[model samples]
Target: MSKIKIMKKFNFIIQSKGGAGKSFFTYLLGIKHEQNKETLFIDVDGSTSTSTNQLKFLEDQKRIGVIDLLDSQDRIARDRLFGSIEEIAELSYSNYILDFGAPESEQLPALFSRDVNQQELKGFAEFLNSEFIFHVIIAGGTAYGACMQYLTDIVRVVGEEFKIVVWMNENTLLNYPKQVEQILEAANALGLDVERFGDVLSGSVFDTKLSTIIQQGLGKAGIMKSGYMIQTQMKKLTAEIII
Candidate 1:
């Protein structure tokens, strides 16, 4: 039998609005990739180190390494960000997951639009022999419009060679099913891949309970250990995502 090909790719989770579940999705993706590959988790979100904190459990295992691009003022050092990308490009053997803060949604797309940055990103993809996929989360309720606009902006900047994945957050889906449908339609119209994330149970008692676990730094594993229901939900959600 012919050997099945293992696809290698870099996944970037970026969104303009805070509380849109960027870190949560990154955590889920990390769990999905942990078993089979040596993955590098880059926490570019200077404003909040949620992803980095969540993945701390892997540090002892040497499964991941982090690059802190933030200065004392909690701002991203542009030069350092560029330099780090170059450095990471050299480590072509491992997969990468980059979690960008809300502000970076604007900055990164602008950077990617530049001819120089575009060439660098394309070169990295080639050098690493991997595909680059941008994961944008579109949540329901008040954040929906801003999230969709961010998605549009990303589509405008990124070239056709790159793939875009739209993740629909289920927390507010019940309250905004029509909006969810609209976003799905828009994503389909743009030829982007779409997936539904399990409900995070935000703004509820259960969410409050989960928050306590998260604050303790156990991250996704904490949630998984919480109960079988959450585990099943997470499994279903992550299973649909193609690395």
Candidate 2:
């Protein structure tokens, strides 16, 4: 495998709410960095395995490793999971996008909140900050309130070391044209630095022409067009991402 070019860059496509396009965006982020830099797309969402499927091509080609977190079961599985996480922390010198499963995200804060054993997770975050620039990708939708709360939960757990990027996934404009305002309000209330977050992006994957063309069997040509459309969307989103 090629060495990662950016050492301190970590992107976690996180959202407690499902159907928010986390996996799709994860695939796009991987594509954005795959060609020019060392990129590792870790699929931690074992339930849906959406990212795992989307990035299967990369895994098959040996360009990425899609880890199905659901596969981590039993004591042995948990041990392996811990080992893998530690190994990544130790050996990761490339850009990484961890598609955190909803169950894991929901459990993480609680797991890390305990007084006695929280040091492990805190240490993990510290290792990330010391070794890589950490980032959180918040996927939001019509449920704007839930989105804000999710962001708050993440910030509370991870602290202020990481930059946040919010994706307006569903009914983006129709639901909240002034979504940024809502975010700002929430940030102010929570005492989070608004400057620490990046601009929001429209992350809708279903409204594209590709989704329509696929039903008509437009084949490779339609697929190519959809790919271009997705690329354009990803370019805009990544451009505003805080390093």
Candidate 3:
């Protein structure tokens, strides 16, 4: 008999520059995962409250775990926030979709900073890798140029151990495919081997029935028309995502 693959998937949806659809994409991925796999969501963007609200539907379903890192500028708050991540990473066997928000957005990069203990962070990465196929998925909005900068910064800090996935989130006036081309050109200019990077997964959730409903903070209709739209887009996006 053939053995089954049981690799846990940990997707940290990130972008230092805000309004890049981090929360939106996180919710989509979480909903998709809940169809089968055990999933957990950590909303670190307490300021925006977008993902926190959009995810309420799932929370009510009692199908997944959700944590909100409190919004604060205090150093202690940052510590507790980072501590929660470590705590969940240690205890959970389910797949994780961590939606990072403001302030503490720098925590992941700080772990690999020269000022911190790189050795310890590296060991933690190893532990996570042992249990999960850890990947960092970045969502870039219409400001494609700024998104490229964030990508490079993360690539520099995290090193090459983790797979980096680029998501072209269409929110601006710029063309989606063009932005993707520019991102690749930028990555090549930075000496990153494009082959190792996961394929660019692009989509837009704006003006959709689901988005409109969520924006209005209305009650769930149960089996919504917009849900089908989201699932269709997510199916394509997830298919492109190399696990």
Candidate 4:
């Protein structure tokens, strides 16, 4: 294997609410990291595996991997997840971006609520010499309440050891301006970093076209190839990401 680059951070895109743009955000972050570092994209979505699907090209190149936590009985297999973590710990250098599905998202925070799991994760981060940053989504519209609750739950469980980054989706921001403001205030009070997306990702004609390309498993290269308008939007969206 090629020498892995020293990882700076292990980023996780997590949100319990579906349609909150977790996979899209993960893809953007993966592309950003891929530009400069040896990065691994892990899709832990047992159900849809949308991130895995979108990043299939990268997986074929061995830059992406999948670890479905659900067992044959359709339950979250904790032991299997820990085993995967051990394998990743052995590769302590390359940066990892994990896009978690709704069920796995909830389970991870819950796991962090336990002291033993928290210590284990802290040890893993220490061994890798990387900071753990959870990129949680706080969207608007009908998902606002659930998203906010999930954020609070994560904060409550992860404690002060791990860093939390909030990604505010702009698609429904106008519809729930007050709620968005509340989230901003809370994030500010908590001193968590906030990133805004969806200006270009808002379901426009070009955005729809871009989404279809991504879903077709062409990844970033496809976006770059599909005309200038989509490429421009993809660039703009990726530019706004601070992770």
Which candidate leads in TM-score? 4
Ranking by lDDT: 4, 1, 3, 2
- lDDT for each residue of candidate 2 in 1-243, tens digit (9 for 90 to 100): 996444345566677666555655564465555454466677777676666666544654455555544343411144444566666655545666687777655555544354213345445656555342324343335556665677777677665544555454533434555776776676667555542222234344534543343234232333456677644544565554333
> Could you tally the backbone clashes for each prediction?
0, 3, 1, 0
Score residue 177 of candidate 4 by CA lDDT.
79
User: What is the alpha-carbon lDDT for the whole of candidate 2?
Assistant: 0.53
Worst 10 residues of 4 by lDDT: 110-119
Q: After superposing candidate 3, which stretches have Cα over 4 Å from the reference?
A: 1-7, 61-72, 75-82, 90-92, 114-119, 128-142, 170-178, 188-206, 216-243
Error of model 1, residue 227, in angstroms:
3.8
Write candidate 3's Cα lDDT for 1-243 as tens digits. Answer: 996545555666677666656665665565455454366666766566566677666666454455665434433253464467667766545566777764445455654564434455456556555332223333434455565666776777664555565565543424456666776676666555442221223343434544665565333343244567654544554454333
Cα RMSD, each candidate = 3.9, 5.8, 5.5, 3.1
- The TM-scores, one per candidate, come to 0.82, 0.68, 0.69, 0.87
- In model 1, the runs with Cα more than 4 Å from the true position are 1-8, 68-82, 115-120, 203-206, 219-225
- TM-score of candidate 4 on Cα atoms, chains taken together: 0.87
Q: Quote the lDDT for 139 in model 3.
A: 42
- lDDT of the candidates, in the order given: 0.73, 0.53, 0.54, 0.77
**Higher-TM-score candidate among 2 and 3?**
3
User: Tens digit of lDDT per residue, candidate 4, span 55-158?
Assistant: 77676567777887777776566577667766875663456788899888877766665534666777777876667888898778888999999999888877
Model 2: how far is 166 from its true place, Å? 3.9
Q: Which candidate is the best by lDDT?
A: 4
TM-score of predicted structure 2 = 0.68
TM-score of 1: 0.82
